[model samples]
Target: MFQASKVAIVGLAFGAFLAPAFAAPAQEAVDRTFERIAAGVSRAGLEPVVDIDHARLAAEAGVEMPPSRVQLFSDAAVNSALLAQDLSTGLDLPFRALTYAGADAVQVSYTSADFLKRRYGLDDTEALAAFDAALAPALDGLDGVEPVPVPTEGLADGYGILTLQSAHDVPETVARLRAIVNAQSDTVWFGEVDFTAEAAALGVDLPPAVLLLFGGPAPGGVAMAKFPSIGVDAFCQKLFVHAAPEGGSVVLFNSIVALAELHYGTSAPPHAMLDERLTATFAKALE
Candidate 1:
């Protein structure tokens, strides 16, 4: 696990010192790289799964904000193979790229498959290696982009994670999560994706895994307002329900506070409360 507080803070401080030297060229490269990445992914036969233009959205809403965007793209076949290796990898799919105008330069970045393999403790080499290879075309020529370093063992420690033993099966747990979100006045059901079904269609064996995304305007808007970059982590919290190796179902979610800290280098009161509410909602759904 990456040390969220220390490493991230220190890295920023160090980066600040070098910001002046890299300013102009970095920003120009970032703009060019974003266009290159979009074209590259399409050329690679991957479709854009999600595209959030943070700058445009803020502008339309009459808010002045720094430029930023988050785009996710992936090929169905490639993703199926990755899911077969470890269902948890679904959280990082369908391949996200984050671009933002930094103090010195516009920056473009994404989590690497190698980094994720280590973070998730995935051991399916053939699948992961293939997944990594598939990403090359999209990332190939980015001048300054690099994946964040990942720890070698266990799950990524920086995330706030909650694992619950479910009394129901995977499908039922998913249904319960959806119903719970629907029942909440402050939350709205965003969507759900089934990695298990996708992998099974490819003749790749995988335990049932479903990702449930949900959150509403108020909490989401607040977090994004506090730190626009928080859109990468807090826009919609995801609850994953999957078959445990031991024969039961398990439910898990990334902690909003931890994600905020990881991405923004600080914590917010609203995010903490939102995390508690989401944790409670999942606990109740499982019960």
Candidate 2:
């Protein structure tokens, strides 16, 4: 496991390097262009799951900024097979796209599926490549769009990542995760996607795999109170269960501390407690 401090440094450095790509889009053109992009994403079959209105939230907090928004979209119907290959991919899902008015030009951006597939060490390159290609239509009519670059190696070296070998198969691992969440208070079950089944229906072969999305209101409320924008990364945690290439099943999730630091630029008291709870939960489930 990567140390929290090390992960923080790496994550910060990467964030800084990518800062330019996230520059706000041009002022006059951003609104219209944003709508077009949003329409395109919908047309591509990616359903909008979360919409974070940074500008409005900042205004409510007495801070001012150009029009900006972040949206997460997902097409579980199509991408389940790809997601099943690597559960860590859930961290990037539903696919996030940001649009903002820059000093010079309005900008729209999203990380490419190819970058994510490689970053997360997911299998089936051909499938991901094709999926990436399929996303072009969404951006076809957009201007000043940027696709964030992800390094080929050390992709997740900056995040607190935990991977465990599961004694049970994929279905059982998912059931265990569900049971664990069900037993907890204030935790919201965000539903599960069985990518293996979704893929099989599409006439593709994907190893047994499932994704569990769950989290509680308390930690999320705390994080959002400190930084509303961080709500994009807060309140939700995911567990991915899939067959390991080496054999057997594996489960994975990002650490709360890492996520807090990455999103808020600082770790909070709640993070430590959340981390402990998550560690214990995973321990019990995997054991």
Best by TM-score: 1
Q: Write the per-residue lDDT of candidate 2 for residues 17-118, one digit (tens) a residue.
A: 221223333333555675787798888876655444444433333444455555556666437645656545654655656665644555565657655655
List per-candidate RMSD values in Å: 9.1, 10.0
Error of 1 at 200 (Å): 2.1
Off by over 4 Å in 2: 1-40, 47-72, 76-111, 114-118, 121-158, 245-248
Candidate 1 Cα outliers beyond 4 Å, as residue runs: 1-36, 53-67, 140-159, 184-188, 246-248
Residue 129 of candidate 2: its Cα lDDT?
A: 72
Estimated TM-score per prediction? Answer: 0.71, 0.61
Q: Candidate 1 lDDT, tens digit per residue, 1-287?
A: 00111211121222222223235444345446667778888888876654544444333434444555555666667777776666666776666676666665556657666666665777778877777677778866666765332222334632456677888888788888888888986554545667766666667777788776555545665665656555554555667788888876888777777766766667889888887888787789888
Clashes, model 1: 1
